[model samples]
Target: MNPFELLGVGRDADEREIRRAYTAKLRHTRPDDDPEGFQRLHEAYQRLLQIRRHQANQQPPVTMAAPVAPPAEPRPASTPTSVIRAEPVFVPQRLDIDAFCSEAFGRAATGDNRMLSEWLQEQPAFWSFRAKADIGQQLVRRLYRDEPAMPTKCLHVLLNFFDLDHVHAGHDALALQRLSRRSQLAWELMPEHRQALAARMNMQRRPLERCLARLQRPYTWWRALAAGFTPNSAKVMPQFIRELAGPFIEDLPPSVSQEQIRFWTSVGHKNPVSGSQLLFMAGVLSMLSLVVMLGAAATTVFSSQTDMPRLALLGIGVAWACGLLWVALRYYFVLDEWLSRDEDEPARWPRLRLATVPLLLVIGLIPCLLLPLSRGMGFTFLLPALWLSLRRYWRRHDHEGFYVSPGIARIGLLIAIVALPISPSWVFAVATLLAWGDDLRRHRKVLQLAG
Candidate 1:
């Protein structure tokens, strides 16, 4: 099936367009909702990603001309009997197999095989065999043709050369299979070659080590360990990190800095407001608010006086409102920056969302105005207002995956409202702890990725 058609995107669609389409399709066909549909969608996404990587790795087309035979001329009439015939001179040039093998090794070490292929084409004896055997077989035969004692280093280099050629050739599956078979034959001829092949294959499998090897400036052992645990490292680094690792093993520029790696590990797989750090902050704020409310309730309930301290309660209420406002403002700016950087969708209703935060804050203070009526009445005013605020926020940002914290926070508020008459302190403490736990879970995942 055509993945582009399945995803409803053009073949030339950018990364953003592909991701957006995938997310939109996911909403309607959740795995639990429609397992078959979700499976198809997931397969299409993976196929497109592979297609893109293949296209990126493919080299420019090289054109070769077929060799043409010269036209035959009619033999001169038998007048050559009277004249002396000139014979063509033939010289036997000795083939220095060792030097040729050494040169091929050097070119392979540089990670480009076009030079080696060109050199082989220039040799008349080998040029005829190029079409008869695969490139790997041709190289192996030439290296061991006359040399009884092939150095281990030359054998190792020959193995690496074949592997690098296959990777650079857009990972053609059939070509790799043929190369692997030819290399295995070479390995069987020499026991030491098996060790070389095993070492080379291991390096290819662990991309983090390969990337570190390409670095011009050596990194500490700890930094290399950290890179292994980065977000999406398992999926991306092994196969595709080489694309980002600049050409030329020596004098290689630092393609990915340590700081960039750290940043990607922390937030690469996360949406703006849904990131573990942001969720943790939201949870902490919710818990603090609940603690202050519960403290005020405890003070009122245990006091001997029938009337609570109005001025002190008012001060606590205002301070709490200001703290909520500050948290809201801080979150808004942080989310704005993250969305601007990562989101492909154009800014829509962000100002409106920011404005709603302050509006909710103002609504939250309505309970303070009603405080003069009765303590129960003031607490009652907060219930519907908090519910409305939570519902609105969820509906607005649910598409961005920011609904979890708000959902948990709303549940906590409901518990506080229900138990306000009986034991506000105890109930609110339990509710706030729940919110904190939710955020803590998200935060732990981010830390794991960062490590």
Candidate 2:
């Protein structure tokens, strides 16, 4: 339900009304008693507060001029009208490289390079080559090598002399290699410049071959991913993979499409529901069911004189399994619905691949593997699973908002671990209940600002 409808308040309701409504609702819907109800109420109250704050901050709209009045004077048809003409303004045409460079050289010749340096200082293009000594050196020697000290502008102007279209000779390649030697430009930018020059010269450019001169330079994977693997990027995957390898000789796999790469990258950021909250609730439910089943089994085992009904025990086991399956399926559908809300083709497989396989291995497979051996063995197995789960949760906290803190999850694990040796059935049950209780309260606070 919408926040306003859930709160039983109008859109214009004040903070006081919202708070009052929330308090009244909380009386009947405590987190421990009715988590879903309390969650809805808390979300409504928070949404209203945000709406109120937004309304208060908004500026009142200013009305513009009303309907314009008709002109008072009607011009006579007989009167001759005079038209005013605007004067033409002169604008200078752009100077070509040859003309600009010639003027700079003339100024330098007249004043021993001082005039040329001052003019070059005002040119923005000169500073772009500040770090390239080879490119700067060509301009330095040609322009002001005889001078005692060279100005920064002279170096800049010299860089502007090279025309990429004219870089056919071996000297051009040598100059570029020398310029790249101690250059401080970003790896991507240097390659980009080289590519542009190659394109202008009508030469085939191989970024992988040209860009990897040094093996010691650090490579940023994420930056490369962002640059080469974005959805709209025109980069070829095979070429990008080659570039990523730098100078390494390992055989690389063929690159996937940009859409596939984007889908995989986006999976990490998807959080339709708070993972910790879901985990807590599921853990609690599982623990309680296990405790009840274990208690019945324990009683049956202790009473050796009386024969237990095998059929009845089998039926109970089936019913418990069905219940767990139902819960799991329901949660899965809910998650699917939430994630499908915005995407056209949600590409569920990629997300499932990223989130489900590891989860199953840690939470389901490991525990199930130990279940056939002993109840104590199963409980012991859970310690490592829970620890791994906690580690996964901690790592994802930055990307996904946490409903329960990693510390709390760790504490819950500790409690279960301690309680297991004493009472295996009670360990999970108590921990699960506590986890849900903690999650419910935390979730309420989290939803307060949502609208």
Candidate 3:
């Protein structure tokens, strides 16, 4: 198609007419409104300019009629009447590279964003091609999944610095979509969190939500087991961890349970990474430990029995011994992550290793180990580890009425757990019951207020 027709100009249309027509058409064909129409308009604008330049170069210079020099001077050389002036080019203006990032990032947390807005005003290139998809994509990468992202108010100025926010097309326009357009892309607080923040910050009644979703899976045996074995959960776990993967425990609202907060962000984050593979294996081995002890007891209980199945017991002992490497590997991963927590990438975690699983195995097996050696020594040996786990549980629940069973009651449960050879299952049972109580208390309190 003719450049002249594209811009709705005559072939002889000058640069001003073409530019005017292009600008007029541009208003009707914004990138966000119709990307294809905008593209065609932009192309027409460029093509018309190019054609004009080519014609200017090819046109003979307008020359004055040579003066009839009456023998005063040799025939005067032809002189051009009009000089072909080059098109005025608007060079993209940019901020100082050194201060560019420092200034923008410094305002990330603050309300005053005049530095960015004012700077953007000075830079005209973003309107042309500077702030296109490539830069927009890079900016998206710089955003945090958990930590408060750049202020949305300031983000608008930055994204729109080059009117390209509106004129960009296709993938480019999508990349540069206004963060303000989607509440999630802005500073959305979680439901419970939003209320807490507004009360704390003295915000108006308007909804205050945009912060990232909390990544939480309260510890449950079923969750741990399923996460380890399910193919879809395995893949999704990693992705969820990545999206809400930062350590923002400090940023949590006061309304949230700190004890539960600690679990979700710290131990909970590690769950998917640990993959519970070792835990699963430990369960199988520990179950065997329970079974063999039960079988031997059954024979003894029913009749004045043959000796305890020493051979079978010894074989299980061997299996348990062999499984030490499995246990060690699990510890290796958990300890590695524990030590590396300060430095490792938040999104990356060791597969098939878990801290609690190993802890449970060790706690459970202590009693089993001593069972053969002495009539009651294993339970005695297991006392200290169970106490320590319980004490830690209480400390974490400092948030509210997290259960810390009285020592006597726990000891009673411990004896039962030991007698049954269920080991860590008791630990899980107590925690689960405690968590249920905490939730019940929380909901009941809310219901009382409503009533």
Best by lDDT: 3
Candidate 2 TM-score, C-alpha based: 0.19
- Model 3 alpha-carbon drift over 4 Å, by segment: 1-81, 84-88, 113-118, 124-149, 162-451
Tell me the deviation in Å of residue 6 in model 3.
22
Better of 1 and 2 by lDDT: 1
lDDT of 2 by residue, 390-427 (tens): 44344434356655767777877888888778765455
Cα RMSD of all models vs. native, in order, equals 27.4, 35.8, 21.8
Off by over 4 Å in 1: 1-105, 111-118, 122-127, 130-263, 267-389, 392-451
Residues 265-331 of candidate 3: C-alpha lDDT, one tens digit per residue: 3333433334355544455567667678888889888978677788568868976887786666556
Candidate 1: residue 47 Cα off by (Å): 57
For residues 5-118, write the lDDT of model 1, one tens digit per residue. 888999688655676677557556766678677667777776666666666779442222344749956687974645332222222244555576667655544434455544
- Candidate 3 lDDT (Cα, whole model)? 0.48
Candidate 2 achieves a global lDDT of 0.45
Instruction: Tell me the deviation in Å of residue 364 in model 2.
Output: 7.5
Best by TM-score: 3
Residue pairs with backbone atoms closer than 3 Å in model 3 (clashes): 126-162, 127-162, 187-210, 188-209, 188-210, 188-211, 189-209, 189-210, 189-211
lDDT of 3 at 451: 40
Better of 1 and 3 by TM-score: 3
Worst 10 residues of 3 by lDDT: 207-216
